[model samples]
Target: MANELTISGRIVSVLPLQTGTSKSGHSWQKQEYILDTGGQYPKKVCFSLFGDSITKFPLQVGQDVTVSIDIESREWNNKWYTEVRAWNVTYASQQPQLQAQPPVAQPVPPQPQPAPQPQATGELPF
Candidate 1:
């Protein structure tokens, strides 16, 4: 059984569908796509949609999307061949916006003290 994996990113390229005949005279077709995950350190991965799956989800380059895939490895002539196949695709918009912050309370100014009024001096009032 193939292990399932999901990844989200923008579409880098949508390669044309490829068709070929197997050694046993069977025809096979597949469509490939490259995704670039925008982040601190960007990453690129190539995945394919096989057979009828290609028509189910029509994808365009430069669009953001989340893709569900299955990982499968096969031994061919003493070498290993790995394939990442997409089974589900969902559109994803750009990063979410940050919430707005509340306004800060301003500090109140200090009030000035009233000056003292000097009445008549200790001496008798003139």
Candidate 2:
């Protein structure tokens, strides 16, 4: 199956680690990033990078990158929170050969319809 979301955007900001303890009694480190996709209104999507993915990408501000993300929604304390988890991310400059998609197939033309026939007018005989 195709990965849920693959978006190309520029990295706007990267947040420092906020230390917290998970329910499993393990320490968790969270880092958030703001990505601008250059839409009608530039979107700033927050992504969480943890462990090795953080070290692998080494996010920096003002870098153009494409992210393979998983979107998730959760309800906490009667409030909903959305998150974009980056499973794969790469610098745009590195993949110049894989830039564009092939053209989409055009739709076929509709067939012509037959003309409507007029009803015969006659004296009523019920």
lDDT of each: 0.85, 0.80
Q: What is the TM-score of each predicted model, taking all chains together?
A: 0.65, 0.66
Candidate 2, 44-107: lDDT as tens digits:
7788887667878877777888898888899999999888888888787653432468999999
Candidate 1, residue 76: lDDT: 93
Error of 2 at 9 (Å): 1.1
lDDT, model 2, position 23: 92
Q: Candidate 2, which segments miss by more than 4 Å at Cα? A: 1-3, 94-126
Alpha-carbon RMSD to native, per candidate: 12.7, 17.1
Relative to the unseen true structure, what is the C-alpha lDDT of residue 19 in candidate 2, on a scale of 0 to 100? 77
Please list all clashing residue pairs in model 2, or write none if there are none.
none
TM-score of 2: 0.66
lDDT of 1 at 9: 92
The C-alpha stretches of model 1 lying farther than 4 A from their native spots are 1-4, 23-26, 93-126
